[model samples]
Structures are given as C-alpha cells and as structure tokens.
Target: MHPSTPTITAQPSRPPPPPSPDKPPQTFLDLITSVLSLLLVSSLTVRSFIGRWQVIRTKLTSLQSSLSLLSDSPHWSQNPLLHTLLPSLLSTLQRLQSLSHQCTLSSFPGGKLLFQSDLDIASSSLSNHLHDLDLLLKSGVLHQSNAIVLSHPGPSSDKEELAFFVRDLFTRLQIGGVEFKKKALDSLIQILNDDEKSASLVAEEGSVGCLISLLDSHNERSIQEQAVLAVSILASGSDEARKTVFEEGGLGPLLRILDTGSMLLKEKAAIAIEVITAEPENGWAISAYGGVSLLIEACRSGSEATQTYAVGAIRNVAVVEDIKMALAEEGAVPVLVHLLVSGASAAQEKAAHCMAILASSGEYFRMLIIQEKGLQRLMDVIQSMPSSDTIEHVMRAISSLSVSDSTARILSSSTLFITRLSEFTKEGSLILQQISVSLLASLSISDGNKRAISGCVASLVKLMEVPKPAGIQEAATAALVSLLTVRSNRKELVRDEKSVMKLVQMLDPKRELVSKRFPVMVVVAVLTGGSGECRKRLLDAGAYQHLQRLEEMEVAGAKKAVQRLAGNKLKNIFSRTWRE
Candidate 1:
C-alpha cells in the first residue's frame, strides 16, 4: 500500500524457535542399563571360552590317566597287549600336546593364523612315529623273555622264570669267559634252528643283536657260521623277524661275512642275507650298504650252494629297478647266464628265474640277456630234459625274453625249440602246457612262427576241446588266434571240422567271453575272409548266428568284423556264376 517509502509488508509468522541444546546428561538408570547389557555379553563370551577350555582339559586328563595306567601295570613289560597299546597311547598324547601348543600359539600376541599345512605336518609326524613304534613292538623284543620261556616249555619253566634264565645267559655272555660265551652262542643257535616257531621265539628274544655282535667281534669261524645259520633261520620265520635282523645291525655284519669270510661262512651268510632281504625294505638296505656287489661276487666265485644262495639273494634285491640296473651294470647278466649253463640243477633253476627278472626290467636288459646268449642256454636246458621246476623257470625265462620281436625271432630259429614247446603243450603238466602255449602265442606273432606253430594247431584245438585248465585253454585259444591270422592256418583250422566247431562254440552268447570272445571272433573273421568254401564251412559250423549276435553287441572291433563277414557274404552271393 505504501509503494514510495519502504512499504511495511505484513511478515509471515516466524518459524517455531529452534530446539535448545540444554538436555540433561544421561541418567544413572540409563547408564546402569547399558552397563548390565555389556556385562551380560562379556559373561556369555567368558562362559563359552571356559567351556572350551574345560573340554580340552578333560581330554588331557583322560590321556594322562591312560598313560599312568600303562606305566603302573606290572605286566606292562611282558604283556603283548600293553606292548601294542602303549605306543599308540603315547603317540596320541604327543599329538594332543602338539595341538594344545598350536592353540596356545594361536592365542599369542603376534601369532599368525594356524595353517592347514601345520596340522598336516603334525599328523605326518605322528603317523611316522606310530609306524616306527609298531615295528619296534612287532619285533617282539619287549616280550622276548616271556616268549623264550613259553616257547621252551619245561616242567619248571614258566615264562617269567624262562625270562630270568635268558637274562642270566645274557649276563654270562657279557661277563663270562670266552669259552663260556662261545658255548652259550652255540646252544642258542641250536635252539633257534630247531623249528620256525623256536626261531621266531629266539628272534623275538632279541638274539639278533647278540648274534650280530658275535659275528662282528669274534673271529671264530664255527661260532660265526652257526650264528649266521641261526640268523638265517630266524629271518625265515617271519617278515617281522627279518625286519628285526636288519634293524638290529645284522645286515652289515652278514654282508661282511659274505665279503671276506670262509667259503662255509660265506655260504651261510649269503643264505642269511637272502632271508633278511625277504622284507623288501631290507633289500633296499642291503643294496644301499653295497651288499649287492658282494652277492654278485659270491655268485661268480662261490661253491654251488653258495652261488645258489647268492644268486637267490640277487633275485630278491633285484625287485628294485635301480638295484636291478646296478646288478646288470655289475655284470650279473653274464654270470647268471653262465650259472644257468653249467651250474647244478638248483642253481640253474634259480639262475633262470633271476635272468627272467632281469629281462623284465626293460627292453635294454632284455636285449642284454639275449646278447649274453641267455636264451640259447634256456633252449639247452629244455633240450637236456630238465626237471619240472627247472623247465618252468626256463620256459618263463624264454617267455620274458621273447617280449622283444628280435628275441622272438631268435627263439623261433633255434633248432627243436618250437618242436619241444609243441611237445610240451601236448604231453607236459598243466603249468608246462600253459607256459608252452603262451610262448607259442608270443612267437606266433611273426609270420615264420605262425608257420612253425601250424603243425601244433591240432594239439592246441584238442587242449581246448577237452576239460583242461582254464589257463591252458585260454593260452591255447590265443595261440590259435595268432596261428589263424595266416591264410594257410585258417585253411588248416577249417579242415579240422572239430576244431572249427570248437572255435564257433567258444563264441556262444551265454559263455563268459572275457578272453575267448575276441580271439574266437578273430579266427571266425579270418576264416570267413577266405574262399566261399571256407565261409560255407564256418556257416555249417554255426558261426553265422554268433557273428550276427556279436555284431549287435557293444564291442566295436567285433561289430566291424561281423559287418565285414556280412559284406563278403553278400558280395559272394551277388557275384555267383550260373552254368548251363
């Protein structure tokens, strides 16, 4: 209304007064409520932590009680149950302590996170300790005193009393005169070699350490020989006993005996080493300690029995590939071949087995054996009418050697080799027949071998037709398959209507075709691929329905074979000739 002068416009009512900042400090009741809630949360956390701690403590207490019980039992020293359970309990305690330490470390001021790797390392260490303890327990050293008494079993002999007697004998050996110690050792050896159970008891009695000590410290050949024989007997008793002998430093002294002792001593030591190496780990130990070289030397120069034992030891250790190669490097191949050629029948058998193991190492060793004329020697063994065991070894050796194509050709070229093998298939034992047929199968891979084995086809078919062992039948079937691969062999097989029927019968749908199916199908496919007359003969023998059935099966090769047979049949029908 007053435009000229600064008109006094009606102002809008002012906004309500801004709120004041004069609120009272938090009240005591509110403070108390907040404190109570915080305390409750803290108490819950503390209770949870206490519960966890109590659980861990209870576990620790229980473990401690178990340990105390074990230690307090009077039979703890001689009871086998305690001997086994104590080590396990101790290992558990160790593991628990380790875990507790980890927990403590995790709660430390600057501790890093406990990683999975830490737990794994702890577990691995526990496992290894337990394994070592188990070995120690199984060694029977803990209960030896009781075992000796129980094993001896005299009128006045309780296990405890027997243990006392053994303890007395050990004491005498340590403090008595030289003659007394020698006599004690002689008696101990005699008792140990009485039987396997006695030997096991003596070994469990912890005589391995004493025997090894005697072998090392005494120069008496009789005592040493007897000690070696006892050790050999003990080692042969059980795998645990063998491991005990090796673990107690017996292997080194035994190897030394083999290295430098008299012929009789070396012979006994070699046998003992053989038994000791029955545990594969002991073999590794012996090879590591240079026992393999000494063994090879003994095999080369020792007497027939010595050589037998030494070569046998070599065979045991040669299971390790590196040791096998080491043996070949140390000229074992030639020595074994020589042994096979001229040694005693036992030596020859062992040498043949050793040669087979060596050859199986790889193609290189196989070739080495062939070059050493090992194969020729095996052929000679067969020619000389070796024993059944020797024949088996020789045949297996030849089978291993024949893995190489070149070796197979060389074998096939040997005079009377194939003939002898065929004769074995016809007239030998089941094992001999099986091995001979298998070798023939391998040799039959070559065309020349197929031709050579053709004459034996009837024998092979007869083996199948009769209720022979499955191994012989399977091997003969495989040999027939190889031989049937040749067209001439197919014609020969077709001529024997019985053999052709046998081949067809093997393909029956209900029969387990695990090994026979493919081979039978192969023979059928080969026969069916021949002239129409061959196909007609097979059809007459009831092969068509089986071929049709197999064509529908899941086997791809078998299906393809059926398809080929069907196609050939169709082509023959379409290309028929009609005469006026």
Candidate 2:
C-alpha cells in the first residue's frame, strides 16, 4: 500500500479547532443540527488520517443519514423517540470531534500513546449509533412518515395509503412517549373501528408487542385504557392479531389490567381476554397465568358488560379439561350460580354456559354444582323466560349434568324442566330443539325420566318429520328411541300415522345423503315394543322394501329390522340374500 493517498482530500477532512458556543440552541432540533454540522466538519477535517479515521467518517455519515431522515419529517417535532435519541446522538458526535482533535495533536502516531482507550470509546459510540440506525430502518417504521410511497403492489389504493399511516402509528406506539402512545392507540382504535380492513393492515405489520408494554403498571390510566382498547379491537378482528398479542407476552399485562384496571379499562381488557381464549389452543394460557381466578372475581363484581364478557371468557378458557376442573376449584361455581340467579340476561346466559362446562369436567364438579344449587338456579332461569338465548344456555347446563344418573334424576325430577323441554321441542329454534332432544335422550336412560318425556313425544315426531335440519332429525330419533322403552311412549308414537310414515319413508335408499341410522333405530324401537297393529301399519307403509334396500346400503340398525320384519320363515331367505 502507498504510505499516503495520492492526493489530500478537502480541508474539511482534517480535525478542526474545538467548537465554541456562539449562542444557545433555540430548540432540541437546532442543538442536534449543530452537533451534526460539527461531526461533518471534523469528519472531513480528519482528511489527514487514513484507515481507522476513514472508518469513523463512514459511521458518522451513516448516523447523519438516519437521524436526518427522521428530522426531515413534517411532524418531526412531535416524535418523542427522536427527541430522546438526538441528545445521545449529539453527545456521541461531540465526543468523536474531541477524539479526532486528540488524534491530530498527538505526539505519537495515530493517537496511540495515552488516548487509545478514548479513541476506542469514540469508535464504539459510532458503532452503537450505527446499530440504532439499523434498528430504525428494519423496524419498517420510518420516523419520516405519512408521506405516501409507491405501494409494493402494482396499483396504489387509499386502502394502501391507510395501511401506510397505520405503520407509522405503530412506530410511535413502539417508541413514542406515554402521551404519544396514547394518541397512537386512540387513532388505531378509530381506524380499526372504522372497518376490518384497517385492522388487518395493523395485524399484518406484526408489532403488537408495544401494546403489552403500554399496559405496564406505570403508564397513566388514560394510556392503559387506550392500549387495552386497541388490543380488544385487534384481538376480536383477526386471528393473526390475536396470536401476535399472545406471542408478545401480552396476556400477563392483560390479565393484570383485568385485575386492577378501572371499570372501563377492565371492560376493555375483558373483551380482549374473551376473544383470545376462544381459540381452543389458547385456553390453557389463562390458567397458566392464573387469569382464571381473576376472571372468577370479575364474574362476582364486574359491570353488566364486564360480567357478561368475563363469564364468556371463563367459559371459553374452561374448555381445557384440566383447567375446567381448576376453574371450578377456583370458586367459579358459586359466583356463576349467583350470576344465574340475579345477573343480567346476557351475563346469566354466559354464566350458565360456564357452569355447564365446569360441571361436565368430572363427576366431582357435578356434585359440587349440586351442592351450590346451580342446577336449580338454571331451572329457575329457564322458568323466568330471560331470553331465548338464556333458555338455551340453561338447557345446555342441565344437559351437561344429565350425563350421570344422580344428576339426571335431579334434572328429570323437575316438572318445570320437562314441560319446558316439550315446549322447546315444539316451538323453539333448531338449536333449542337439538339441545332439548339431547337432554331427553340422556334423561330417558333412567326409567323414571321416560314417563316424564311422554309430553315431548308429539314434538319429537314433529321434529323428525322435517328432514332439513338433519341434526335435529337425528337427535329427535335418538330421543324417541330411548323413550320407546316405555309402553305409553311406544303407543303414542305409533298412534300418529303421519309421523310413523315420515320415519319409514326416510329409510328409502334413494335419499343417499340422508343419514338413515337414527331413523332406522327409531323404527326398530317401535317394532320391538309396539302392538301387532302398529307393526302392521309400518309394514303397510312399505317398511319391507325400504328395510331391504337400507340393509343392502349397509346402514346400521337396518339389518335387525330386516330380520324382525322378515320373521322366521323369511329370515333364512333374507340372510341368504344379505350374504349374496
């Protein structure tokens, strides 16, 4: 290598005399601008040195590039991160100027004598600034923002413009001050609430980690409220957004807000919790962080909306089986029972659902609910006619308990419940009918409950007649089949020719998409226990041909009916035919 460059650079490349303050900087921006000028002057003044000095000049130019981009923004005055960064950057540049001067005056070569450490310090500071610059660039958040750029996609859209604006606000959220974060979050809420597309834009940016930080205890109440509100909006709108919030360690602060935040803030936090826990994979997170206990408290004392959302959140999280039992153990039951008795219509509905989940986790939980009189409270709410939704929730709770004989007895023994079930099957929505039929199916397992379900028999057959809602049709058949163990139910079932014909006609193999298993089961139930004339009515309605086709279709419950209807003489022929 040459001992020196072929030519000396500009005089600005050499170290200049030390800066003397002429006048105080009018503002922070002015101060940073003065320091930057000094750095450029000294960087060029060091033109006398080569190698290491060249490297420092390169870093100084980079720091200047990054900060200048930030300061170029029309709204630069409002950026707190820039305000904070400028002072540190100014100090770093001033130190570099001093270091350059020392290197120049040094008696030894390259400032190698006593100032080597200080030179290293100056180089390290420049490297730090370079690192900060890299972060600012990679954040995909330009401090110089809201100036529309060409969208990566072919055509520019206002939609794309809105997305660019959201990216800038997210940067503010990430590094802006308390008030900045608050304002950023407020704007985000407005944008997100305006439409779902705005929400998707923010979620695609994937930096919701700032939301968790804003939920920190030290933030002002207004800031925390806006932070959680933003979370609630994002969480409810997009799956990616929800996962982002969870991935960023947001659940801990969210649960903390739920525990200690003000009424409005708590409500916002609860909304986020309710939505996040809806994903079954995320259910365990609540109990993992002991949020379930906090939710239980919310159920006890949260506002109507809060109580409603909190109960929904608890219900959602209790889907994890281990957590299900843990939720009950955490005292969710009694509060749930209290909600069922006196909470608002919506809260009661959610509480009933949560109760059902907790009760169904184990026999121990069922017994615990019984101890709390939760079963009766559900029946009480069902009788109160709170809302169709509430009725369905209560019915679901009762049905969950009816899985066991002891609980089934408690449910079946309620005359009001049995009567309501009959009414629901006749007049309720498809969902209610399905639930009602399911309850009756479980209840009919006990002979005592069988007689009680006789009033529902007319409605069950009516339900089976409509083949559109196949779920209700299937459930109705199962319930009717279970009720067939009783003599009166079997008689009443065969008495309706229109109803019996509907069941037999559905067994035809031509209805390929229709599920024939449950319908066949119901037919077999009646044939086994009905009077001779009832069997004659089924045969007259063309049961033989349908059963033959269904048996060939390999429909379960069809073969037994084939043998029974074929009797002994034809049984051999039918069996041969079946084998062939």
Candidate 3:
C-alpha cells in the first residue's frame, strides 16, 4: 500500500466542457430565431425570472411565430426594418440574460433600485422591439422588401416583371422607414429615368400620393428634395400623371417645401408646382393651399432655377381667372419685377412671363406692375438685349403692360425702351418682331410716343418686307398705321420707295401672311397724310388692282385710296390727250 501511494498523479478538473458555444446564425432568419431561442431558454431556467417566465415565454412564442413567416419570405434577408431592429433586439436580449443571471443571486449587486432600473430598460427594449415588429407586419414591410430587389433592376427583366416590382415599391413608399423610403425613391427615380413609360406606371400605382406624403417630411430635406423632384418628373411625364398628382393632395406639401426646404429643394418643389398647376384646373387648389404667397417668395430668393420655376408656377396659376387676384395680392407682380431687375436672364424671362400673365387679368395687374417699377425693369432688360428666348418673353411682358394706356405712357416715356424695341423689330427672331411690333403699336396709342416711335417705322416696314407670319405682319401694319399719325413717321415711310413698294406688295391677295385691309389702311393713311406724290407712288406700285379687289374682300379704306389714284390716272390721261 505504501509503494502504491508513493506516486499519486494530480488530475486537472475538466472545466465543465466550456459550455457549448452557441452555433453562429447563418442567415437573417437564423439570427432572429437564435435570439428567440435564447430568450426562451432564459424564461424557463433563469431563477430571477420565475414570476414573469410565463409572460416572457408567451411574448417570445408570439415573436417566434411572427418571424417564422419571415423565414419563408424570399427576400427576408433584405428587410431593412428587420436589420434596423435586430441590433436593438440582440443588445437587449444579452443585457436581459446577464441581468437575469445576476438576479438569481441572493443579494442585489447594484442594490434593488439599480436592479429594477436595469430590468425596466431590458423590458422596455423588448417591448419596443415587439411594437416595431408589429408595425412592420402591419405595414407589409416583408412584402416591400421583396420589391427592394428592384435596386439593381435586372437589365433582362420584361415590362411585366418591372411592373410587379414597381407595385411593391409603391407599397414600401406607402409605409416604410425613412432610410427605406429613400432607397425606394432612389429605385423609383432610376426606373422612371430608364423607362419612358415608368412614370405612368408609378402614377397608376398611386405614386403621387406616396411622394406627396414625403413632402411633409420637414425634418428631412434630402427626402423632401427627392420626393418633390420625383413628383416633378411624374407630373411632367404625362397629363394623366399631373392630374393624379393634383388629385392626391400633393399641392399642399409642395408649397410647404417651398417655405421650409433648401434652395435646391425649393427649385424642385417649384418645378413640381409648375407641372401640377400647368393645367389651369389645378390653380384653385394651389390658391386654396396658399401656395401663391410661397411661390412669390420663392421668386425673391433661392437659385436661378428656383426663381425661374417659381415664376413659371405663378404664371400657370395666373391662368386661372379666379386665382389671378389672389396671386397679385400675394405680391407676385412686384416680386417678378424685382427678378426682372436682378435675376438671371432665364429667371427674368420667366418672371416677365408671369407678370405678363398677371397683366392680362386687367388694369389692376398692369397698375401693380407700373407701381412696382416694372416698366423700369422692363427697359433695363430690353437694353441688355438678353437671349432671344428671353427677349421673346420679355417682349410679351412689355406688350401686356403696354395694353394699358397708363402703363403704356410710362413705357413710351422711356426712350431707351422705344429705341431697343425698335431695334428688336429689325433683328432677332420672328417672335421678337411680332411682339416688338405689337408693343410699339400699343405705345403709339399715346400721341407723345409717336416721335419716339418714328425711329421704329423703318424697322416695322422692314418686318413687312421680310415675309414673316401673318401675325407679325399684321402687328407691323398696325404699328405703321399708328406711327404714321406723326408727320415725321409718314415722311419716314413715303420717302423710301422700297418701303412703299413693300407696303404695296403686302396688298396682294396672294400674300398669305398679309391682311389686305391692314396694307390698304396704311395706303389710305399715306394718301390722307402724304402729298400727291404719295398717290402717284401708289399708282406706280400697281396698288389699283388690289384696291379694287379690297372692296370685294370686305377691306375698307381701299376704295377711297383707289378713287384718289383713279382721279390721278384719269387726269394724267386727259392731260396727255390735250398735249397730243
């Protein structure tokens, strides 16, 4: 026995085989289920949770059942809401497990209140996760996740596949987290840009309602910008989409963006507004939403694109007869005039266009423009000879303002305006010629403007000779008739044989762009205002045939001018016979 006891081997106690490390979760469903299993184990075995084990067990069972459906989902791994909620869920479970283990001890390590506080935190975290999961289930986020596969948009996918996918995108938009919505919006925008027909698809899917809902995201500028821009694309995509946007109560949110969003956002919102209100039928809703004031304010600040689109929106709204007064009251006219003075050419052109629309409402807007120093701004822009497109719109604004004698007097008094306008009649596009001719005619209504306009007669005559649209020619004829009221202008016209010949050529019935009556009126005006040489000039230019045909065409003033010419022709024959 002593020999056997001589050498006793010391055996190291095998530490309880390193409590089998829980297997790692391989997928989203596996990870979620693993946590649910841990919580289930904790409820059953943790001594401190004895009283609440049934409650915790019931909660986890329901959680497990709800998530089992997620396991069956094809794209469950892509559920952003699940991903976002997972970390919180895991952290709370770990904390609860540790805390519950500690609670099993005889005394509270951190005292009773501290232990209770830890328990409250763990409990609240679990409850919050459950609540969020419930909302996710209700929101059909699982279904939405399936649509998120559209992020890549398989190049080979057919329209039907894409359509089914888009239907899911809109579902997410109807109810998804902020980041999820951003992803959905990004995917939808790309789809729209890639496929020309995608807009109508999304619109038919009620995308307008989803997008408009995001415009109220005052806390999220990026989301707001993306949403409003998406709205703009859909709105401009087709008239039907625009109607959908209007029907979806989108106007209010867009105007809200104009008030609170960034400059770029304001531009996008304005663009959306422009497209929505493009139909005059939508104007009242904008006015009802108090968008007019926001739009006017937008024209005052923000980027050039913002101002331009804002002005364009106002112009569209102004087309509604009922909203015009409300638009003016919002100070749209003054704001527009201010832009004309200081804004970029594109914005100035749009501002001018909007003001032109306001002016058409009647004397009130015209006076408003004049009171706002719009005439001064108009002259300023015209002096610069802005882009042809800009000039065309500016000319329209000036023409609108010139519709009123009061505004006309102010415009006419600016020598630079008349000089620049006269220059416009000679050069630039056909629209410029027509608008300038019309503007000059309007200005010439005041006798005092005629001398300032006499310088324009040569250009007006040149416009007639250029063979342009009938509208331009008619406007030039009217301008010439008005200008010839001044003796100096008649001299300016009759002294140039080419000018008289151009006017006579316009009398030809074959000239489609010309109104015979206008040319005849000018001839009559020349005959009434010019000397006998003018009458002989008419005869020499072969105006008699047209004059005789004028009465048949219901054109007045030609017969009198024809008689004057006939008398001259007969007198010349008699004199020739006597001499013989």
- Measured by lDDT, the strongest candidate is 2
**lDDT (Cα) of model 1:** 0.65
Give the candidate number with the greatest TM-score.
Answer: 2
lDDT for 483 in candidate 1 is 74
TM-score of each: 0.63, 0.70, 0.68
Cα lDDT of candidate 3 equals 0.72
Give each model's whole-structure lDDT. 0.65, 0.74, 0.72
Tens-digit lDDT string for candidate 1 (286-318): 667888779889988998889988888887888
User: What TM-score would candidate 3 get against the native?
Assistant: 0.68
Q: Which ten residues in a row have the lowest lDDT in candidate 1?
A: 20-29
lDDT of 2 by residue, 7-71 (tens): 75322233333333332222545665676677667666553344677788777777777666655
- Compared with the true structure, what per-residue lDDT tens digits does model 3 show for residues 485-558? 77766777777888878887888888866667778878877776546677777788888888888767777887
Candidate 2 lands at a TM-score of: 0.70
Question: Superposing all C-alpha atoms, what RMSD in Å does each candidate have to the true structure?
Answer: 25.9, 10.1, 9.6
Ranking by lDDT: 2, 3, 1
